[model samples]
Target chain A: MSTQSTRLAARFMVAPSVIVLFIWMIVPLAMTAYFSFRLYRLLSPDRSGWVGFNNYVWFFNSPDFWLALTNTLLLVGGVLIITVILGVLIALLLDQPVKGQGVLRILVIAPFFVMPPVAASIWENLFMHPQNGLFAAIARGFGAQPILFLESYPMPSVIAIVAWEWLPFATLILLTAMQSLSSEQLEAAEMDGASALSRFRYIILPHLTRAITVVILIQTIFLLGIFGEIYTTTQGGPGSASTTLPYMIFKQAIVAKDIGRAAAGGIIAVILANIVAYFLMRSIGKHLDA
Target chain B: MARAASPRRRLLTTLAAWFVALLIFFPVLWMILTSFKTEASAVASPPELLGASWTLENYVEVWSRSDYPRFFWNSVVISVGSTLLGLAIAIPSAWAMAFVPGKRTKDLLMWMLSTKMMPAVAVMIPIYLLFQQLGLFDTKIGLILALMLMNLPIIIWMLYTYFKEIPGEILEAARMDGAGMWSEIAYVLTPMALPGIASTMLLNIILAWNEAFWTIVLTTTKAAPLSAFIASFSAPQGLFYAKLSAASAMAIMPILILGWFSQKQLVRGLTFGAVK
Candidate 1:
């Protein structure tokens, strides 16, 4: 019964959270929109002018913008490809009846919980350092020069670190989805003389398609906002060699003090994220029936 | 599917799985191992695995050299404070949306989730400037508020999913017995949703603790959490592998253990209830 009093109480209950989040969303968003048009530099506070579209023009014209865009796409796409593929395979491996399954899971999923900065520094210094790092030592042991990971190969190295951090997450989610698949279907297929490959092709692959999509969308959202790993390792440098979109905005605002340019880049990032999020929400929002 | 396999096959698969698991876990394992080594041994080329002498000096130094305790305290306060704050704001809203009739409830929830989609950097400049104007930059309260708001949508959505599962008849019965809103939640909903609330709190703390981007940006020394504290190690000090590992292990150990406990909720909460 939706009585007047109950409805009133419900409205009251929901208002505080809604109001706060609404303000949080609209305020900064409006400010970003406002600042995108105005030239506001942090250093030169006296210089404020309404130069419409100039900031966006300058932001687009910058060479670093294109470089960061390519790196962003590469990071997201590279991490997505590696994680989803390994996630499926590892999910399959973990789904098998192995001894010490719980221990194996703890080991595999541990990296996802490592804070990004810690993970990156661990990679950068402990493993990827030019001379003293473990990878270097391994290369020396193999009678070859250690490949400078963050220096000569920043993109791939960052991709590897980010992928290492995420592979566990993808594996965990895909494993959950895999476990939900009814084993009876597999048993029946086996009884019908189906080979392991055929059973997997017909049953497991179809079952995993939804989980795969979920992994891609969720990981894409996160991969879009990656900052800590890049920040700690390369600081988006060796000259914008490893710059992601988020780090670039931070650099522009905090380092360069180019608020107008930073705001424009931020708007561009929001549009890119919303594009992926729109597809993500549409596809996965349907599954969230509680 | 559950049939017994040959002993050899079982052993082989077990070996293979453990190898892969350890390979994946090597970085963390190596960090922990390195934390015990001397600085020289830490950087020694053919990197020391077991031959290096172990000592508690690195841990002791890491604790003594910097304001580790302050960062630790800040992390605890921000993570726990934000979780509690998010729960306070989310519970009533989630309860109302879950139990009450409203045509726009679904849309409202989606809108909330979409807010989470807005990349944090997009609002970076505005929030950064606003924090300065509001004098919230690099304060514990400021970080608590930002993280609470950042995580509120997920908290509300998760609690909403939990609240939706509780049969309405129970709450309705409470209302029939003259329990008002406060008593109803205090007595009925609280007890019923305790597990979900607990898991939600755990997940939120883990997230807030690991949050690096904003924590790094907003604060330098005063309000820096373990994230920023460890990030400081990323500078020249990162060359000191043992101390860096020591600081990192200390920073991540608590969340790592908590994360292990919430692995199930990690999937459900992170995917926004899409998979589970």
Candidate 2:
């Protein structure tokens, strides 16, 4: 199995994927690093020159940077808390001996399939619009003034929409993990006079810890760079209320056209993501060995 | 625990589960219902759910007035094209890793998974510059390549997990019969792994379809997929509720169907096989 010729062929086979991924990861990253040290604005390309650490300084110094960082943390934290808690509950519920389980699973998992922009717009316009949205209509039905959801609470509004989109994913994964738990274990515990609450706390919750961690890490990787939901719903607005790190960098690059500073911000994003990836890879690596 | 429950308890659980599912599904349901209403009736006071006058006018208008078909076609091309490209590259690699173990295989897999953790915005500036410089801005090919790379890790991880379940002895047996490598893969391995390959393709397609960041950033009009096309409706405009609903429904319906089919595979795919 470890012959020379077979190993040669295996290397040849694996080369393309490895090589392409290497270039995909390294090349743009190098370019981002290169441009980050130089002063280059998209609007005025002729006045370009290297300015060591200036872009980083400018990007880090901005109050918007801190705001964006806080917003990013809040967005990730909020979505994780919501999705994990609700995901566990819904998954536990769905795992019950319910009638029409297939249809119920389908209904619960539908939101994860909707495209982000569609999800955002549907919520923003149809559900959150103050004047004519469904919520407005419901409020008016009770003779109460309609609350302008995005206007008043942009971060929460975006979080709720994102949570809706991601709740299905968490539920699906947790449910899969739940199904793997042996029913005999719970029954045995019941015979030992364990109450339902204690059974959940000891048996069910412990069983789901790995699945919950997987959900959080995977969701955080995607959530840190959430763009479409904010872009479609709030536009990072009522004056940067919902702007996360990625959206802030996006605005710097696309809207502000300051290539150098944007590239610096891009590097910052890479560093931040790598920190999370370090922990995620560790967990997955342990799982791999197990 | 499958304990014999009373009828009332069984009925209670069923009702509770159904209630949560419907509550979660209500927004999509509302969107679909809104699509059939007249523009005026779509925003009617107190919101008519069932009483609104249903019509096909919004669908007709969305089809005719906007570039809906082009966007839909663009979505189809990019998602399918990227997923196919990803599979082509991933299959050989996954095959190698699964059958031919090497000292670095685990490291290689972890490294590949680490690449997925690189936030897209980190390279957005450079990629955007490169795309503009190469005259690939707003082109489907550019997006196809970008998205292929973005999702390449998941594709490889999913295919690898699937391929691992395939017995290496079969390939060794084929080798013992003097079958060539390509023949073994083409004839023996391909048939055995077809179901896994198909599921990988399905999950990849669904991911590519709903991919928002790169699709929206890279393409403007000509290559704008349904994701970007739907994003265009963010601007406030009068009398667009029905049209927006129609467009949103069309964008999500196909993938929603595909996603439902691929739910089992999705947990593995997205989690990099960290979760079963």
Best by DockQ: 2
Give the alpha carbon lDDT tens digit for every residue of A204-286 in model 1.
99888878888888788788999999888888889889998899899989999999888998999999887877777687756
Candidate 2 lDDT, A1-290, residue by residue in tens: 75899899899989999999988888899999999999999899899999999999997888889998899989999999999999999998998899999999899999999999999998988889998888998898899999989999999999999999999999999999999999999989989999989999999998887888789878988898899999888889889888999998899999999999999999999998888677766766454442
Model 1 spans > 4 angstroms off: A280-290, B176-180, B235-239
Q: Candidate 1, residue B162: CA error in Å? A: 0.8
Error of 2 at A222 (Å): 1.0
For each candidate, the DockQ is 0.74, 0.80
Q: All candidates' TM-scores?
A: 0.97, 0.97
lDDT by candidate, in order shown: 0.89, 0.89
Clashing pairs in model 1? none
- In candidate 1, how many Å is residue B275 off? 2.4
Clashing pairs in 2: none
Tens-digit per-residue lDDT, B25-123, candidate 1: 999999999999999898897877668989999999989887888999999999999999999999889989988859999999988988888989988
